[model samples]
Target: MPSPADTLTSDEPVGPQLATPPAISIQDLRIDYGSHLAVDNMSVDIERGVIYGLVGPNGAGKTSTFKALASLLKPTLGKIYLNGHDIVTHQRLAQANIGYMPDMAPVASDLKVWEFLDMFAGAHGLSGKEKSTRIDECIALVDLHSEYHAMCTSLSRGMMQRLVLAKTLLHRPSLLILDEPASGMDIKSRVGLRNILRNICKSHGATVLISSHILPELTEMCDEIGILHKGHLLDSGPVHDVLHRMTGLLPEIKIRLAEPPDMHWKEWLLAQEYVSNILGEDATHFSFHFEGEESDLAELLRRMITQGYLACRVSERQRSLEEILLDLEYDGH
Candidate 1:
């Protein structure tokens, strides 16, 4: 994985976000099939030039919401705007600004990779030299230049994904709505896709709204994420912010003692107001959840080493998405 500094550069634009309308603005969006409600009243605003992830379990309304945003499905109620253009009333303008790629995006079995891209480029109004140059650029962007002339069927599953992604990029749309784009990709291809998406955000200033079942992958790539369950958005924000919002979750603290302490030491540690869920006792190391502020933890650590003379190393960790989501799912039940 790339370091934080490498993946998230300070040079990326952050201010003036509100000066321009959000790349995507969903208002009271709802989708229903007969008596079954697939999506509830979900509202979210995705800023420009950032990757926003939407994740949920099976039948979680992810696809329903995505279709509505892509203008492929008319919501039972609500409005969707892409770059300030209403999807229903100004579809042409809205569609012109977005490229939607669904899971298992198909390709022409008889067409070569470049030919496939060429067709979309022409449809997008490119002509002659411009069309050819765009095809080449998109192919290179996906790292499929090596397979430029190969038959779409001949390409591997991962390569097929790349071909569709290249197709999605032909018009350089400002908003990219990709549903499970990395579904069939291998580890290397997944990494390449992450890098490509980041580059697209940096260079082209495109906002990516992607959905995936893989929670951890989104954690690494997206600037923000929304958790959808049974059509309702449980929470959405930066990873740490969402983590802290979930109940029963706190910053975890691990303590490495200078040596194994007596039984009384456990009681003393439990006496701390902020400490909870202490674990392990057979060794010099132990861990617990801390519900207090950073200053409280620092003071507690100081007291432990100074008064108890048993502490050595103390470190803090944020909970992972898997842990938070599991608690969320359980709580919903």
Candidate 2:
């Protein structure tokens, strides 16, 4: 078996070039199953070397959208472009550039881990020495070296997930679509998967589209995010920009008090004109939601201090991507 470093190098291309183009692009994409329209007019652009998070509640059409992009399910309307080639017309060429791992496990329980990866490498047209080398490279990439010879049935849920990822990388596609890749993983396994995704995006220049209900996990890994709600894309953009837009001009702020405050203080804070909402409150601290001119917030703070409140600490709170998405739903969309 080749060393891990050597295997990594083998999977990367040798030459340098400009304008590699977006790994995947979708425009006004829609998919219908019989009378039900699962995805509705969704559009997105995923550039190379970036991890894009596709997040939504269950049955929000995230899986349907991914299937259309992967060419596993044909769209009822609109177009999909893979590396600038139209998937509708040039499906074979387009598919060659994508590796899709569906939500359900795709592994063959009877096959050994190494054999399964080797099978996909062969399907991608690798032959002889090249095929063997690529299979080894994929196995190493997913850190399945120890379990290479183990039967698929014998591996744990996390190990099986790693094997599926290895299969996806066998073809060395520019785009990877993983639908709930961490579905049944434990905390440690989930973190391990996240690290692998980041490294793949940074080192191999692969664009990854990962859909998950775990908002916090997605926030840490994705460069851009798309939030789908009720089959409509509620918001999609850079994480910080989305948060800023949803909450308007008010900055999220948190304050730590030297001692626990009473409910009276909480009520007073919420009644302030500059404060929009109270995100959370506990014995030691409370977080306030604000929206308005920055100058107005400064005035409110001054008033609080002058009113004889200790106000031991004050800092702008950073909204998580999940918070931003939940806030967007309140706009009556």
Q: Write the per-residue lDDT of candidate 2 for residues 207-269, one digit (tens) a residue.
A: 899997678888877888887886788788887666555554667788877776666777777
Full-model lDDT, candidate 1 = 0.83
| Model 2 residue 278 CA deviation in Å | 7.2
| Each prediction's number of clashing residue pairs | 0, 3
The ten-residue window of minimal lDDT in model 2 covers 8-17
Summarize candidate 1's per-residue lDDT along 1-333 as a digit string, tens digits: 223432324454332235688898888999999999999999988889989998877788988988998989999998887877677866676677789999998789999988888888888889999899888888888888789889989999888988899999988888999999998788888998999999999998999999876778888999998888889998988866765665353677888999887777778888988888899855788989888887898898888887665787888766677776676577675
lDDT of 1 at 190: 90
lDDT, each prediction: 0.83, 0.78
List CA RMSD, all candidates. Answer: 8.0, 7.2
Output the lDDT of residue 76, model 1: 98
Best by lDDT: 1
